[model samples]
Target: MDSSAGHTPEPGSPDEPVVVLGVVAAPGQAIGLARKLVEADLTDHIQTTFPGARWQLELLEAGVVQPPAGDAEIVDATRDLLLEHEWDLVLCLTDLPLHVGKRPVVAHANAVHGVAVLSVPALGATGVRQRARGIITGLVGQLLGADADDLREHQKSPARSALRHRVRQLGTDVDEAGTAFTARVLTGNLRLLTGMVRANRPWRLALGLSRALTGAIAAGVFALVTADIWLLADTFGGIRLTGVALGSIIAITATLIIGADLWERGSSRQTREQVALFNIVTVITVVLGVAAFYAALFVLSAIGALCLVVPQVFGATLDHPAGFTDYLEVAWLTCSLATVGGALGAGLETDEAVRDAAYTQHPAEPI
Candidate 1:
């Protein structure tokens, strides 16, 4: 058995079957969980879908491979990789987007190569197991030329799976499937959704901005207690707080964007169009996130002032009155201080977290 290139010929008997699950560019966590979920009940599911066929499912994580071109290229590349192993059928799951012409496809399989490739973006926000189940079942049914009933049995039955809208194929005899796949993928606009999801992972963003946020909080607290800050707050009003929030958001966002770009430092040069899009989305996400942070800090400062302030010393300069105005002065001072502290925190942020918050296209290269 030459495991160099070309397809692995299938066994003459249908009694025993060899299936390989090849993972490339897939997230480590998702793959681990999905494999456990599928392997637990794979035999039963396979038997139900294919009746009396005995199957052996083997899992392989190939890490990152050189990316291929289009659907046909991916089919060829997947087949080539599987040729080195003894497997009758190979299911390749990749995190990278798979495109057919202008539209991105969820999955594509070649009956000739006995190989299928599924794009992770097609899974949406569903649990890893269910997404994997739907894709694998669909591939098996399509690859083996299953009867309509068998195919129907494996295809995602739940309306929420939304797998129907996502899964599609090319480079096969399924012309209608190819056309429909393109149309559905384009209409669904999964590419944009995938980017948004990638960019909007709040936990990742928070981790990236941990130091900056901490600095801001500490600064806010200090400002709430300091005499100079109170004096400045007395001189200004809501105008001062608004300015502080805007300034802080801008400073933190710029720091993240710059830091991420430096960290990523792609080998390939990005085009103007790519640069524009990246900047636009990065700015938007940062602005939205920082706005929330700033607002929360503002509320915290207000509350802290009410509880911690000795009213007489904190706002003794209101040449007019001493009700909510005093607290407002303290809040304004804290907001400004917090923004400056957050800027300092930006310097303390780790490069990795900044990259996570800023990038959607490429993973951070090892430092």
Candidate 2:
């Protein structure tokens, strides 16, 4: 698909309500995917949500941007970005997580201004294309006060939204919204939270680990064959052993994150902030998954070594006693070796998989 499609709109009638939906996705393949996803679904979503009015909803790639801190700031920023353009509605969809007070907000909108911004994370395990379409359409119905009765029946009231006693508005505060549709803009309820949690899948962690899988495995095998397992066990004993295990995981995860293709074409601070946050989250999730895999591999490698290699053959040359010490020693050596392997795997990882692994918002800044 042409990258230009995201920025340009098709000619339309002046009488129709022109809603320019600005999707700010991560740079590169993800942005392209975002554009395609929005273009294919925006028209149907608007029509389904609002039925009657003649509409000209255009999906624009609003470049790359990190969502601002506060809900009010986000609304103002979204409105300001589209002020130059005559728009009936401006919806900015970002990968950055948004929050109101301590609770996570799915989406935020200023109905009076006809502007809304939603977090991609809030969509939770829903496909990017489907969830993006739903949220944007829902926000449109929300901002215009169209299909209120139909939407409300399907949606929960603000009272039932908060997991805690205080039901804080997820989008814009009720008093500030200035609409009778007042029941809290996209009520941040239990259902929303459930979807968000479901969206944070473990497969993402696997993707990170996959980046270095081959190298990690090769290195483990090589280390088992050559490294002095007995000495390694003696050096990294008890609590210190845990540190070695954790270090291996961190090293591999960091390699994938640093080497992964996450650069956006935007030079803005918001772009940089979004990219930084994305990297942090990706690295952490990868670490959790990779660590578990590495530990299991280490144990299996140790068992294989103990069953195959006679400790007595190297006992005389060993600095430490063999016994059960050999098993811990071999495991530590193999784990450390796997990290080196991870580095090699990082280089071989595909561009598609890397982009799929990270949360996308927009394109990279031109060098």
Candidate 3:
């Protein structure tokens, strides 16, 4: 066997057969190779000139290779045919630069039947596809030995494994970007992405992010609800006031980001979109929150209860500074449960995130 440029021709044995799996570069590649070997019997082809398209078609018209039927996606058809065709060996002639190794055939043969594979730079359709089939079978058989590792363990091998690991890292990078953006505003846990980060990070970023998001959300909601009935249109309880909830949300975000930055310098994020969205949601949440309380009153008032606050959108001022101060105090209290106000009024209830995160798994894991 000349393993230099290629394998030597097999000695003729009518009874014994060679099992081959082919991987051609594309549809044209497969067609050309099959034509060369079949119609033209041009068995000795190594590399050919960039001959005109006429030369390309002469082979296809010769019926040496097969083209897929109408309306079928090429890659899928290849797999279906490969799996359906029963033979000692599988020959793949791909015109597309796709993978035979990626096929279920290869996976089944190696992972199940313990086959292995052989690879060589393709010369013709038959040889290239044959070698791919052989190599896959060979690998499967080798891995199927007594000390065999499961597909998962074997996949951790250095050469191929790094690619897998890098893909996972890329996924994590996207996730990290998302978390950082979300943490600065609105309310949603970023823990979804933290699982794939290196250990200990899951604790710091995931847990911390969840808290910040919840605080921001709570503050936004409180602001939206209370701002309407706050006091007088722009005033609080009809008196001038500071924006307490807004301040609390900002304080929490700043403190969290700053703390993280102090510990893991330059690692924290500040995104304007996130902050802007948070602000918008805060404005809306305040309106909704106030309305919601009124709604609660309207519903309870039906049953006769004291939960009713005035349902009016505007009213006489209590006094600008005092009203504003009161609103600010409410905002501040909205952001802090364990800090300023008692635990009942601030942040989100515990059940919200726990309920959402239920059954959620790390995105990178394989089925």
**Best prediction by lDDT:** 1
lDDT of 1 by residue, 24-63 (tens): 3345654665577555885566545443234456677653
Indicate whether candidate 1 or candidate 2 has the larger lDDT.
Answer: 1
Off by over 4 Å in 2: 1-58, 61-154, 158-200, 203-211, 227-229, 238-243, 263-280, 319-321, 357-367
Off by over 4 Å in 1: 1-204, 262-275, 357-367
TM agreement with the true structure for every prediction: 0.46, 0.48, 0.20
RMSD of 1: 15.4
Best by TM-score: 2
Whole-model lDDT values for every prediction: 0.54, 0.50, 0.28
Query: Order the candidates by TM-score, highest first — what do you get?
Result: 2, 1, 3
